[model samples]
Target chain A: MSATLDDLDRRLLWALQDDLPLRERPFAVLAARLGVNEDEVLQRLRRYLAEGIVTRFGPFFQVERMGGAFCLAAMAVPEERFEEVAATVGAFPQVAHNYRREHALNMWFVLAATRPEGIAEVAWAIEDAVSLRVWLFPKEREYFVRLRLRP
Target chain B: MNGEALFVPDERDRALMLATQAGLPLEARPYHALAERLGWAPEEVFARLARLRAAGVIRRIAAAPNHYALGYVANGMSVWDVEDERVDEIGRWLAEQGEVSHCYRRPRALPLWRYNLFAMFHARERSEVERAVAAAAVRLAARFPGAVRAHEVLFSSRILKKTGVRLDF
Candidate 1:
């Protein structure tokens, strides 16, 4: 992932991340506000997506509200089998965000599914398949979730 | 699902949701683009989106920023072991703090991981995160007394897998 970014890229990012206007030509509105042509804004956004600078560029749903399940799961894989285990567990479509963390339980990932009940079952299956104990930590309650960074 | 679930989506609602899960096209009429792609009328798509937002099914239709790229490199997941009885109350208070981007109540993995309460604090520097964690600890200690036990902040080393929540329906 490239760390270097320019001023316009930064502004575009901050602008898009904000609640965009709910309208027919939202990007055009964004361009109008950013003082750039709609095409330039669109091209850069599409480029960001193509280059993986922005993994996603769209609506964020409250899946839980839609009866979906999301959980944070982890497993302590022996150093030798870490990659294999990661690939194995990550193959599951339910797995969304996975990370390597600095802890005894190092390989962490988020499991999500439209059918909320399926998350636990899939967690169990992942554990069984990997032959490593999986620690499934489903959030009983979320205190806060608002996240934003000033670029 | 809770017995008192806020909203129960219909087939059409699900279709609209699944279609726009990745995102709406960056166009003047984003909903128009969505409708064109999904073979539905723009009015119907727009109306459904409005209803979903009102119902809280759609949290927000906005840009998802890559924080690390913006130089906020340090992401700390702080886990706390708080007394079960007063957890909900403590969680509510912690969630209000500005530094805490995300916080949750998770079950304890006793003998291994005893911490149940988890809050993620992010910053550009590890020392900054640690300082904030320390301050948060002091604040929590003063507020909750003996109910709040030990805590640990686990920093992420790498992005093994990160993507939009992929739904297979």
Candidate 2:
């Protein structure tokens, strides 16, 4: 869906995405910088959330730094077993996000654990429980990309 | 899903989520630092994060230090065409690996874009990604003989923008 962004709204978004400043009264600081009131800052934020401009507005952890292992996985699921397999996969604590794709390998999701070895364990668990062949596609390197929305 | 309902974040939880998404202080006491800045109690800050976690809004609050700067330079998006009967299990298994961080199953394109399962892999060098892909291919071929009809790998050239979270206030 298209996002309707005004000057003020864009300002707020730009500031927040860059990283809130470190200081007492950050809202006030932001407001002053944007030439608006703290309440206005809060109100606009509320509107933004209500408008669904943001899918998630919370802290995201660095799995590796946090002593955890995370990876993205996909499987080709039969039509009849879609829901059952999705539920099973989602039940795992490591499975963070699950999606239904239109392909032979329709099921996809993420998995994370405290240890690197846990990767294989979780994968095996799902394979055994689901009774399907599983593939382990791990990241060999890292590339950080921050997607920004233009105002 | 309706676009309106899909993007809306609850008002009560906006402040905390916004703070984290915007970015957190790289300090010993990050939570405390945020509390001091927001003029709220440290416990309050932690409490909000906990609530967000429980609510499935904030999945995890942590850092994604500069990957490229740190030397993990190789990365690629791999797509596979696995049999529908085994894709679900295979996807879950793949996600359980540490190397694959981003996984998705998009609607398959016709003859040209037959690979439906997409997974992101990061390595210190392009060779690492190739090795991983080859290994994964071998595993798949052994596990599901004659199952995967095709596969493709696309490396990321230049990262444009990747942050998706938006906090309006």
Candidate 3:
């Protein structure tokens, strides 16, 4: 959750969230549309990124058709082992996000394996390393997973 | 396989995608319609989208095809007690099924949680989904002994909201 953004910030965010200028000097293009100078556009974006309000201002791909596999997994790690488990699991290139929830299943993350089997290997490796049972909760149906950020 | 980074769309392209995803107005010349709202050329809008597809930002800009809108309604998350050696093999089989949309191997619970392999299936009703899962389980079990352990069919109760990424630039 985030606070409401100012009008100018909202408009700028709407543009970036939906689309970003693909040119080398994308800021210049965005500035022209905003009726602001390129420097101002760049500075605002830098500030936003620094603030963590914009976790990632980049592109994301739909991997299924491209022959990639991804899934979300959670594990009930003891509070004492949270740091150790997270560090070990987070090291994998396939692991996208890892977070601690407030339930018996506290640790969760999304892993994208280049190959389908790679997912199993990663899961097994983590289980062995952590000496904990990992519950694989792959999305049965992606009814909805999108997040709406209205600045 | 490694591919070039997904293309980030320009403003016009973004507008088109957002408009479409947010629920397109059932009006003629939808592209032109949105173009007017954005004060841009419709051709410019189409061209930007074409560039986006070429760049791989969009997998496809087609209709909702199979699940949400169409007839198949019941959705359930299927979990399996697959061995570390056989989970990948089982996941691939699930991926090939028409009813299966999402498939992956997640970490299992340390001692009691033996189910690590999971897949999602959708159908018209709860019965339809149950039948599909029964068939899938049989296929999975035939390949690996004691493959199926606990499969929970949690039906979706409500939809809070569904939208894409938040951009606050």
DockQ of each: 0.68, 0.06, 0.05
Task: Write down the worst ten-residue block by lDDT for model 2 chain A.
Answer: A141-150
Query: Comparing candidate 2 with candidate 3, which one achieves the higher DockQ?
Result: 2
Those runs of model 1 whose alpha carbons end farther than 4 Å from true positions after fitting are B1-6
Model 1 per-residue lDDT at B83 = 95
For this target, which candidate reaches the highest lDDT against the unseen true structure?
Answer: 1
lDDT of 1: 0.83
lDDT of 3 by residue, A1-151 (tens): 2434578776666555555443435556777898887777656665565554454443454544334566676788887887777788777666766655444666766766645676788888889989997666654433222222334
Better of 1 and 3 by TM-score: 1
User: Candidate 2's error at A56, in angstroms?
Assistant: 15
Where model 2 places Cα greater than 4 Å from the true spot, the runs are A1-58, A61-151, B1-10, B27-29, B167-169
lDDT tens readout by residue for model 2, A88-121: 8776766765655444556656667656787788
Q: Which stretches in model 3 have alpha-carbon errors above 4 Å? A: A1-6, A23-25, A144-147, B1-52, B55-169
Q: What is the C-alpha RMSD of each candidate to the true structure, in Å?
A: 2.0, 14.5, 13.5
Candidate 2 is graded, for docking, as: incorrect
Judged by DockQ, which candidate is best?
A: 1
Candidates 2 and 3 compared: the better one by TM-score is: 2
What DockQ score does model 2 reach against the true complex?
A: 0.06
